[model samples]
Target: MTATDDAAAPPLDVLIAGGGYVGLSLALALKRGAPSLDVAVVDPAPAGAAARDGRASAIASAAREMLTALGVWSTLEPLAQPVEDMIVTDSRTRDPVRPVFLTFAREEGSAAPFAHMVPNGALVAALSDAADRAGVTRIAGSGVTDFETGTAFQRITLADGTTRRARLLVAADGAKSRLRALAGIQTVGWGYGQSGIVVTVKHERPHHGRAEEHFLPAGPFAILPLPDNRSSLVWTESTETADRLVAADPFTFAIELERRFGHHLGAITAEGTPRAYPLGLMIARRFVAPRFALCGDSAHAIHPVAGQGLNLGFKDAAALAESVVEAARLGSDPGSADALSRYERWRRFDTVQMGMVTDGLNRLFSNDSPALRIVRDVGLGLVDRLPGLKRRFIGAAADADPSAPRLLRGEAI
Candidate 1:
C-alpha cells in the first residue's frame, strides 16, 4: 500500500533505502525501540528474496546479542551452527599436511562460541519476519530513485512512482550505493587483484562445528561448518585464477577443491553453483550528509578475511537506531545535524579501525614472502601460547565496543 493510503498518514520517521540485513535490522530496531516512530524499507527485491542467498556469514558474538535483543535470534537459533572451535594454519595449497599454528576452543566460562556460522538466507528471513511483526513497512519490488532534502523532511521518490517523506534517510544500499553517490559521498579504497570463490560443500563426515582458516599464499581459505554435515567455503585467489576455477567443469573443479579441502572431511562435493566476488576495501569519506546517513557497506566495505563485514553493518544499524530513537524521545528532530553527527562519530572510528585491520591482514597473509611468512607464523604461535592474549582477542571478537550502543549490548535503546 502507498504511504497515502490513510487520510491521516503521518510522515515517516525513517526511510531506509535498502532492504538487506543492515536496512531491515535498522527498521526493526527503530520500531521496537520507539514504537511511535514510522519506519519503512525500500528495496527492489521482493520479500523472502534473501532466503535464497546461498552464501553464509560468520556472525560475531556481539552481533548475535543484537539479534537476540531485537527478537530475531530465536527464529534463527534452530538453523544456526555454533563454531565450537577454530583452527588457523599457514600453508601452501600443495602442502602434504596443514599444521595448525593457532587454535581457539570454547573456554569453560566463555560467554559463547566466538561466533556462529549462519546461512545468509536464514538470518535475513528472521530479520524480515521480525520487522513485519514490529509494524515496519517493507516497500519491496522498488527502490529509492531519488530523494530531495528539505528543512523538515526528505522527500523520496521510489522506482514505482510513489513518494515517501521521512525525517531521515539512510543508505544501506551496499558498496556501490547509488544513494551515497547521489549525496556526493566519495569512497577511498582499491582492489586487491583477488576474488573470493564462495560455495557450499557437503561432506561425508560431520564437521562438529569446527571452523578452519587456512592462510594460503593466495589468500585465506575458510571452511565454516553448517548443519547437516555441510560447510561453507570462501576460497580466495587471484582474479584470473578465480575465473578459471569457477568456469572449470564440475569434475575439474572438484579435483582442485579436494586438493585444498584435504581428506579429513572424507569425500566432498559441491552443493550449488560456485560464485566469485572481487575483493576490495571501500570506506566512504563521510558517513552522513544533512538528513542522509550511510550504513552497512555504504559506509565501509572491508576484506572478508576476518569475517567482520556483516557484524560491522549490524553495529551501524544498532548505533543509528539508538541515536535516532533517543533524539525522537527527547522531542528533537531525528534528522537534525546533531543526531546524524552522533551516529557518524559513534561508527566512523570503529569502521575505519576494522578496515585497517582487515587490509593489513590480507596483505600480510596473502603472499609468498618467506620472511614475512616466518614472522607471521611466529606471531601466531606466540598468541596461541599466551592465554591472556588469546582470551583478549576472543573477547574483542565477541564483545561489543566499549562505547557500543545499548541495543548491541543486549539492552534496549
Candidate 2:
C-alpha cells in the first residue's frame, strides 16, 4: 500500500508498466476486482510527488461504469463533466447538406450517463487512493529499462536497477510502449497525414453540457463541454497546418481557431498552451506475447474522431483484467496462451472494427466532394431519425450488455 511496499511486499501476480491514466486505472481495476492477488504499478514519477496536474482525460460513460465497479468512480464524479447532447454539422457548407444531430441523453430507464470529462490529474489521484485502499503497492520513479519474458514469468529491470518478476506483465504505457517494443510485438498501422491539436478554451457563451462535432473540410473540429462553460477542443488539421498553428502566438492561434470555430460559442479565449498529437491508427499484430499482455494505447491507438480512443483502452483493460481474474477463480494460469487469447478474442474484433470506422470516417468526412458530402450527411440524418438505431448506438457507447465481461458490465469480474 505504501511506496516502500514495492520491494518489501511479496512477489506480485501482476506488474504494470506506465503510471498514466490507463495503467493506473487498470491497476486499480485489477486490485479491486481481485483482492487475493498482489499488484505493483511501476510509473516514472518520483515517489511522494503525487499531486501532478496539467493533463486531462475524457472518461466515457462506459469508463465511469467500469470505475464504479472498481469503487473509484464516486470520488471522481466531482471533477467530471457530464455530456448531455451532441451536435454534428459541417463547418464550411452553407446548407450543411443534410443536417443531423445526435443526443445520448436518458430517454427513459437509462441510468448511466453518456460521458464525462475529467482532469487527468484528478483521475490519477483517485486511482492512487483506490489502489491504496485495495492494497496495491506502488513503485514510483521505476520504469522498465529492460524487460525479458521468461517461460513462467516476465522479468523487468527498473530504472533503479531493481528487478521485478511477475506472473503477468501488463503494458499500460502510452502510445510508444516500451514494454511492447521490448516484447517485439509488431504493430500494423501508419500515421495519418494530420495531427490533432488539443486545447481548453473559455467560450463567450455556455456550452450547456453539449458536445459538438463540426466536420470541417480538413477534419473534425470537436468541442467537448467542461464544467464551467469551458470546453476542450480537438481540432484536427493537416500535419503541415497543425505545425504552423501550434507555433503561432496565442493571439494568432485563437484568431485562426475562432474563424474556423464560427459563432457557435461566441467569442472564445485560449486558456492554455495548445498541444498537438499526431493522429494515427496502430494495432498490435498480437495483443499478448507469452507471459505478457498489452493494454491502453500500448495495444492500439486510433484517431479521436469518435472520442472513444481512451474509452476503448479502458474496455481493453477491463476485459483483460476480467479474463485473468476469472481464470484465477477457476484455478487456471491466467497468463497462459489460452487465457490471454480469451481476452484477445473478446477485444480484437471490436478494437479493429472501431479503428476502421474512425479511420474511414476521418477520411470520408474530410473530403470536400459535393456528392460524397450529401450522401454522408443524408446517411447521418437517416441514422438520427431511427429511434431504435439511436438507442442501439447509445447502448453500444455505454457498453452495457450481458455478453460483456462482468467487470465491463459494472460487476466484479
Candidate 3:
C-alpha cells in the first residue's frame, strides 16, 4: 500500500532511524524497559545476514552488562571469548612490563568473565532477536525522508513513503546521520591524522584470553583474543600508510604486522581483507533539538583507542530510555524538549570527557619523543604496580557506575 493510503499503520511512540547495533538495541531496550510504549525501528530493508568477511567490534564488559540486562547475555555468551587480562607495551620496546592483567574473573573473584570479544554479526543478530521478542516493528528497507512538526508530534515520511507520527524521532543512523541533519543538530568534530585497519589473524600460539595494546609511534596496534585461538587486530597509522598497507599483499602486511605486533603469538598469519576506517571524534554541539534526539554513532563518534565507542553509545541508549520511562510514569511527554535536554545533560559531560581522554592518549602515545617515551612508560608502569589505582582504572573501563542505564547496571531497564 502507498504511504497515503487509508490503510492500517503501526502507531509508534518512537520512530528510530537506522537499524544497526545502536538503533535496534535501543529499540529493544525501550520496548523492554517501557512495555506500554510503541517502539519501531526503520532501516533500509530486509535484514541482511551477518557479514563475516568485513567488520568486527570489540564488546567491552559494560556493553555485555547492557546486553545481559536486555536478557540475551547467555545466548551471546557462546560466541564470545572471555578477556582474562590485558597487556600494554611500547611497540619498539624489547621487554614489556610482564603484561598488566585485569579480568572480570580476576577482579570480581567470580566465575564470570570480565568481557566478551564477539563479532559484529553476532552482536547484531542478538539485538535482532531481542527486538523480535519485544515486538518492535521492523521497518526494513525504509528510512526517514522528511518530517513536519505539529507542536505535539513529528510527522515522519519514510523512504517507502510511509507516514509515522511519533512523539520522538531518534537518530541512530550512524556517523553520518541523515535524521540528525534533518533535526538541525550541529556537531563539532575533527579527524585524526590516522586511519585504523581492522582484521583477524590466526596466530601460532593461543592468545590465552588476553588483550594486548602496542603503543607504536604511528598509533596503537591492538591484538584482542577472540573465540578459538584467532585474534582480532586493530592497527592504526597515518592515513597514507594505512591505505598502502590495506592494499598491500597479505604476506607483506603480515610481515609488517609481526614486527609491530610482536611474534609472541608465534608464526602468525593474517586473514581477512583489511578495512581502513579514518579515525575522528564527532560530538554534537547539542544532543537534542525540538522533537528529535541523537544516540550512538549518530551523536558522538570518537577514537577507538580505548575500545569504548560502542560502550558509550549503549550508555546513551540506556540513559535516554530510562529518562523517557520515568517521564511517562510522571504523566509527562517523554519526547518533549525538556525530557530530551535532560538526557543531553547527563550524556554530554561524559561523552566530552571520554573524547578528550582518548584524543589526548592517541596523541601522547603515538610518538617517539625521548621525554615522552620515558614519561609515558613510567605512567604505564605506575598504574600497573598500584593495585588500587589499577582497580579503579579497570573498574571505570569495565563500566562500573558511570551514569549508566539500569540495563548497563546489569539490571532490567
Note each model's CA RMSD in angstroms.
Answer: 1.5, 2.4, 2.8
Model 2 residue-pair collision total: 0
The TM-score of predicted model 3 comes to 0.93
Q: Stretches of candidate 1 above 4 Å error?
A: 1-9
Q: What value does the lDDT take at residue 35 in candidate 3?
A: 84
Which candidate would rank higher by TM-score, 1 or 2? 1
lDDT of 3 by residue, 30-97 (tens): 88877888777888746664323245666767788888888877888888888887878764544553
**Model 2 misplaced regions, further than 4 Å:** 2-10, 47-55, 93-105, 108-112
When summed lDDT is taken over every stretch of 10 residues in candidate 2, the lowest stretch is 93-102
lDDT of 1 by residue, 1-413 (tens): 22443213567888898889999999999999899998888888876787789899998888988999999898888888999999999999889989899998898987678789888988888888888899988788888898888888888888877787888999999898999999999899999999999999999999999999999999999999999999999999999999999999999999999989999999999998999999999999999998999999999889999989999999999999999999999989889899999999999998999999999999999999999999999999999999999988787777646678888788888
CA shift at 41, candidate 2, in angstroms?
A: 0.5
Whole-model lDDT, model 1: 0.90
